[model samples]
Target: MELPKGLAGVVVDQTKVSSTKNAVLTYAGYPIKELKDAPFEEVVFLLWHTRLPSADELSEFRKRLVSEMVLPEKTVQLITRITYEPQHPMSILRTTVSLLGTTNDVKRDDPPRILAKLLTAIAAIIRIRDGQPIKHAQKGWGVVENFIYLFSGQRPTPERVAMFNTVMVLHADHEFNASTFTARVVASTQADYYSCLTAAVCALKGPLHGGANERVFKMLETIRDTGQDPVQYVKDQMASGHKIMGFGHRIYKNGDPRAVILREVARKIAHETDNDSYFVLQEQIKDYMFKATHLHPNVDYYTALIYHCFDLDKQTFTMMFAACRTAGWLAHIVEQQAEGCLIRPSSEYVGETNRHYPSR
Candidate 1:
């Protein structure tokens, strides 16, 4: 029997967290188009519980998440020391997640607290690398608002908050992507939350996964700095047999729904931040790619510009991905652990299987 490589299209397990069936992304069966404008915390609650939170439940959930968005002083001191090592923020984040498990009361930490800590930790990594003191979460602010404040050290306008909230909501989950599956594989071993998250971060650090956003921004910078014609840039890149960084997806042959919504967010934020030129360059490339290859932009395409408009360095982009995705990772970890089954799979030996070992 011929098996699909990378387990593509194989249903290894069932999930209620999110889905991409028919190329439409949904959280607990609610389409992302409707949920993207919903509060980020509400979307998180939906991912975790498979239902949207009631009014009081959402309010309390928001408060709890904000309140827990603080790190232990010892953790902060340790993070400050190592975050300036000239390492990628994603590398720092990978270590910080494992450190979090050891430094805190890991056993008692629930998903709310774990998610809050990761968001705060990712924000702190960016701030410390930039030589800025970390900011505390403000009372009465929502999760996305306080997250922006923590990293940027400024209160975002309500409009900015709404836009970023959509970014977070859109990235909160995808059913059984590589990193989520890595988390679930680890969780099937009954590992702690941080371990599963750390494994997920490692998987996300690869160029093909979360790291694609940074490369997308790098391509934009190359084109803008050289003043190259945008369409020519695509032609030249493909002529050299290089894959375009942000075009195409494994599942969505038509287009990524998240990219459709994020295109507007990126447009608005880019205009606000005087980054309209980059956005223009993106449109040229997007149009050319579609006409040339029938490949549309995925979520990573516009999100690069969106993060740039927020004043984030390209290196920390995947860390931002991790922050939003921790919600989904935690949800999957819980679900996988509840099944209480170890994820062991059989494989046909593809190498020379009959070779006998020589006596040493």
Candidate 2:
């Protein structure tokens, strides 16, 4: 049999959490374009429940999630020790996530609490690495507000909160992407939530997956700092057989839907933060890439600028991705666990199968 490479176009199982069928991303049944501006907590509720929450339910859910945002004292102490190691932020994150599982009460932890702890833990990683004091989550603020304040140490304005909320929602889930698939495979083994998430983080640490956003920013900064012609820089990179990091996707050939929404957010935040020059260079490079290669930017493209505008370091970009994606990861873990199906697939053997080994 001629098998598909990397299981491309293969449907191994089903999901109710989210989908990218027909190249349009939807959570439950609601399209992402409509959900782009929805509250981050509301989108989380939808992903876990497969339906929109009632008003009272949403209010309570937000409170519950926010309430669980505090990390255990032992986890924080352990995170501080490992966070400043001379390794990539994603590597530190992988270790920290495993530590969370070890330090916390594994048996009693549920999805909401796990998700909360993951977010808070990610923020702590950022703070510790930066040598900044970790900020506490305030009681009256929503989840997004607390998250931003936790890492940034400043309360974001309403407009900024809305933009970051959209960023988180856009990244919350994509069905069967590499990291989510990794999480599902681990979950199928009846593993704990932290184990599943740690596996997902490892998969996402690859440059081709969640690490693309950081490379995108590095490329942008290189072009900007060197004052090179953006178009020529791209041509030179391509001529040398380099893959452009943020300009294409496997699923969306015409364009990434999330990129469409994020482009506006990137523009707005860039202008407000006086990073318009970076945004201008991005647009120039984007046009050249499309005219030259017929490739459109993916979600990582605009997010590079958006995170930069929020004063985030490029190295920590994938960790931010982990924070947003924990929701979908937890949701899928729950689903895969309930289904009780072990995700063990078979492989074909074609290497000299008829040959017999001689005694040696």
Candidate 3:
């Protein structure tokens, strides 16, 4: 039998959490565009339950999530040490997620608490690395508001919060993406949530997956700082055999729907933050890329600019991706556990199959 390399276009299993069917993303049967403007908590609830939450249920769910955002004292202490290790933020995050499983009562934690802690832990990693004191989640603020405040150490305007809410919702899940599939593989073994999340983080650390956004920003910075023409820089890089970081995607041949939404957000925030030059450069590069290669930007394209507008360091960009994606990871973990099947698959051995034993 012939098998596709890397399991490309293979349907290994079924999931109810999300889908990329027809190149449109949906979470639990709701199209992403319809849910884009919904509260992040409502989307999270819907992903977990496969149904929208009632108003009262959403309120409680939001409150519960915010309340659980605090880390245990020991975890905070450990994170401080981990953050200052001069490692990549994603590396620090990989260790930190594993640390969470150790420092907390992993066996007793559920999805809501785990998701909340993941958010808080990610925010804390940013602050600690910057030598800023960690901020506590405010009691009455919603999850997005509190998450922004925790990392940024200031209250965000409603418009900014709304933009980020869309970011979180858009990233919440992509059915059987690399990291989510890694998470599900671990979950199929009935590992705890943190273990599944840790494996997912490792998968996402790869450049072909969640790490693309940081590289995208790095490319922007190189072009901006060096006074190189953006178009010329891309041309030179392509000539040198370097892959452009943020263009094209496997699933969305025409364009990424999330990129379309985030392009607007990136434009608004770029103008607001006086980063319009980068935005303009992006548009030029985007247009030129499409004309030259018919390749369109994916979700990471505008998100790099959006994070820069938020005053985040480029290295921390993928960690932000991990934070948004933790909700989806938890949702998938739960779903895989419910199905209770081992995810082991057989591989075809073609390497000197019958000759190896003779010499030994």
Candidate 4:
């Protein structure tokens, strides 16, 4: 039997996940350059439908998400009970997300409907961790605003809503990412969507992927409080071969595009909080780092500042990432399941094989 060429990056995944040369396409299939100015709801719709919704279409899409955003009273109570502990909300949230699979009775046949269910479960978990009073999803709010409202029980200002929207859009779907790949692997096993999603969240719980941003912020805070020059601080730290949290990536060799957008959002939030000085120092460090080494910032670099502005608990930061990434997780899971391919791979055996005599 011909052992087939190892499919080494042969677009084996799907036509969907492949990146087109020089095109910044969103998960939704629209060019990012165009959607950058649009509300994230539009982007979400595009991801689901593979085309941007018109004004009316977007309005209807928003209504569906708003209506679908509600979590059950039981879920609210569950999250509240977990708050009894001083453990970080993210830890609780992550645990709760895994628990969702056990309780939700996930349906496997219809992928879109399953994705919708995941959207609700993830949003509720995230909102509960943010500690906002419960609000039913019927109030005609978008996902970003709803998430904000669920956290604060108040309407997020227009600008903040836009920023949140930007965050969601940027986070919605990263192509073939670690967590996304994990979801695909699970789905390829013919498991239910919820289980695949739960697995993805579990994958994202690691610090290298979903949870690095909070640490990045903490690092910045430590350096700023020490009253030393941040450039010197970063340079010395990197010189000593200490891995800075938000500086590297497996993709986007040119730079992480999301970081550029997030930096602007961080600056905006900093201006909103009158924390411009701290933000300015951060900016100076970013400039110095980029100038000194051409390596640009990754997603976590600016999300750290966003977390600071939101007054979010540092430990819960990755939970927020998991929440936003549910969109991508669902997308990949459905794509893999629909494609109907097994994800199993083989490894070359390199172990000692003559030990059969030991069995005798």
Ranked candidates (lDDT, high to low): 1, 3, 2, 4
* Candidate 1 structure lDDT: 0.94
Model 2 / residue 290 / CA error / Å: 1.0
Name the 10 consecutive residues with the lowest summed lDDT in model 1.
77-86
Give per-residue CA lDDT, model 4, range 34-108, as digits (tens): 555578677666665666678898887777666656555665567677764567656666666666556554543
Candidate 3 lDDT, 78-99, residue by residue in tens: 9998777569999999999999
- Model 1 agreement with the true structure over 1-360: per-residue lDDT tens digits: 789988888889898899999889999999999998999999999999999889999999999999999999989988887787668898899999999998878776999999999999999999999999889999899999999999999999999999999999999999999999999999999998989999999999987899999999999999999999989999999999998988999899999999999999999999989999999999999999999999999999999999999999999999999999999999999999999999999998778677789999
- Mark the regions of model 4 whose C-alpha exceeds 4 Å error after superposition: 1-11, 17-25, 84-86, 105-132, 357-360
Per-residue lDDT of candidate 2, residues 56-157 (tens digit): 999999999999989889999998888776778999999989998899888879888888888899889889989999888998799999999999999999
Clashing residue pairs found in predicted model 1: none
- Tell me which of candidates 2 and 4 scores higher on TM-score: 2
> What global local distance difference test value does model 2 have?
0.93
Which residue pairs show backbone clashes in model 2? none
The whole-model lDDT of each prediction reads 0.94, 0.93, 0.93, 0.70
Q: How many residue pairs clash in each candidate?
A: 0, 0, 0, 0
Model 3 lDDT, full chain set = 0.93
TM-score for every candidate vs. truth? 0.98, 0.98, 0.98, 0.86
Error of 3 at 284 (Å): 1.1
Task: Look at candidate 3 and tell me the lDDT of residue 306.
Answer: 97
